[model samples]
Target: MENKNIIITGTSRGIGFELALQFADAGHQVLAISRKMPKSLMEHSNITCLSIDISDENEMEQVEKFVKDSWSNKVDVLINNAGLLVNKPFEQLTTSDFEQVYKVNVFAVAALTQVCIPFMKKGSHVVTISSMGGIQGSMKFPGLAAYSSSKGAVITLFELLAEEYKESGIAFNVLALGAVNTEMLQEAFPGYEAPLSAKEMANYIFDFSLNGNKYYNGKVLQVSSTTP
Candidate 1:
């Protein structure tokens, strides 16, 4: 494949950083957006790490400006991987928890997409990462009601967007992945061991974000191990 312009959120570490590294290694220019730019991502010539919190609605304008001014007003692949996971039972969750989680997981995805889609054209791809917990009975965990629900909202947003932008030839997809060994997963489930590592999950996610839309758009792909 030819070199493509890519944008990824939550690139400070874990799957997001791994995805950026994988893409940069393959010669693609990646705009890595996170709260802070780590030296790991900064060292890559093909990677430009933007320090911005996607959850903050106002910060999205910075991304738009950077894309237009620095990288030209063109983006081939947009990945919404930044998310907030608030682990709490439905009964203990307050409205504030819902607001915070939804802001990062759902609203941020929608906001960033809105800002970036203007620069994208036909053949562009948008991939938003969701979780298996978002799917009913997919990961039967006690806590995380708010987090799971927020992820579900992300899946719905992209599904509608795919239909609305089908004529534009822009593909939109959701990857409802199972637990991966990341700090976020560890925080959510203290001692539970995830079946997949961040690197393994990043390989799958990076590939799908790059090419899975060739066959279909607006599909929520459930990625998990066969064994429970």
Candidate 2:
């Protein structure tokens, strides 16, 4: 990953935070984006923090322009790790909740990718963070209809994008994370126990990014700490 420049969304906390740190530790220049800035992240020469809401088109475009201008048309990776979740029975979920989740979880990923695509050089990997629920619905869970549906849409978009760019040297894949201890999950399941920590999930994602290959392109991987 030498000379790689990574733009990671949702970096204020959780797996996004850890991923940004890992990328910086690996000596790759990282552009960390989040709606709110983290007060405690240690300043690093390789890391540049940008405040931008993934759902905000104008702000995201500003990020794109900054990357293009600063890096000279080189965006090594675009990680769509921002997401939203609202748990409630399908009937209890409001139309506003559905629209909100879709805007950030699905639309932002697509829009941000499109903004970065023109400047992405060869061998760039586009990784989107989805969830296990996207692959197989969890019948036992409540209020995940909108979230799961949005993640499923992201997976489908990644697959289509991979097919479209297969001959163009860019790779696309979705990491369908399972039960990571992030604030989003905490909001959905107030008393739920998390099976994995955000740092652990972030490590797995960084490792997966390092192993990019055409064979794994278009695939959705279920990442769990206890899984083989």
Candidate 3:
């Protein structure tokens, strides 16, 4: 790596936090954005932790300011890892619940990417994390209605973006992740052990974030060992 500038959202904990650590350790200019401050993330000299809820459109402006002042308004890699999962049955799920989920998982992705597009030049990659539940090889688990739908939209959004920005040199892709043993997974499927840990998932995500788009464009990769 050539000391690239990297931006990773949802860095409060789990895979997002791990990604922030790896990038910072590699001597990259890493910006870790989340709603709350992660103490470990704040300690790294190469990592800048910004506490901003992506669902709030106004807060994304802070990213614009930070990029302008610190990175000269240019970024090499952008990891859109922030997500909100609404674990509720279809009958129990209210319209508000779905809206809230979309606000974070879907709309916020577009909002943040829009704000960051001005900073991205050629060879820049946009990697957004999706879920297997939204695509094939997924079991359509209970309480994942809103979550799966949002992820499905994510898959489509980046696919479209890949074409829209093809001439601009911005590569876009989605990683439809499986059950990583993160807090979110545990909350959804209590007492169930996932096949992979957050660190394990982070390793794969880090690799894809770096070079997966070199050959593939408008792609959605279902990252998991388990099959239906």
lDDT, residue 197, candidate 1: 90
> How high a TM-score does candidate 1 get?
0.96
Rank by TM-score (best first): 3, 1, 2
Best model per lDDT = 3
Provide C-alpha RMSD values for all models, in order.
1.4, 2.2, 1.2
Off by over 4 Å in 3: none
Give candidate 1's root-mean-square deviation (CA, Å): 1.4
lDDT of 3 by residue, 1-228 (tens): 588899999999899999999888978889999988778789889999999989999999999999999999898889999888878888999999999999999999999899889899988999999988889546898888999999998899999999999999889999898888888887788888888888888988888888887877889988888732
- Model 1 Cα lDDT, one tens digit per residue, 1-228: 889999999888889989999999999999999997889899999999889878888989998998899878999999999888888878999999999999999998999999988899888999999988777667567788888888888888999999999999899998888878888988888887888898999999878877887977999989877313
- lDDT-better candidate, 1 vs 3: 3
- Identify the runs in model 2 with alpha carbons over 4 angstroms from their true place: 137-140, 225-228
Give the alpha-carbon lDDT of every model: 0.88, 0.83, 0.89
**Per-residue lDDT for 124 in model 1?**
91
Q: How many backbone clashes does candidate 1 have?
A: 0
> For each candidate, how many residue pairs have backbone atoms clashing (under 3 Å)?
0, 1, 0
Candidate 2, residues 1-228: lDDT per residue as tens digits? 366888898888899999998888889988888887676544877888888778878778788778767888788888999888888899888889998999999999999999888888667889999987788654335678899899889999999999998887888999887777788888877776688889988888887776665458888887754421
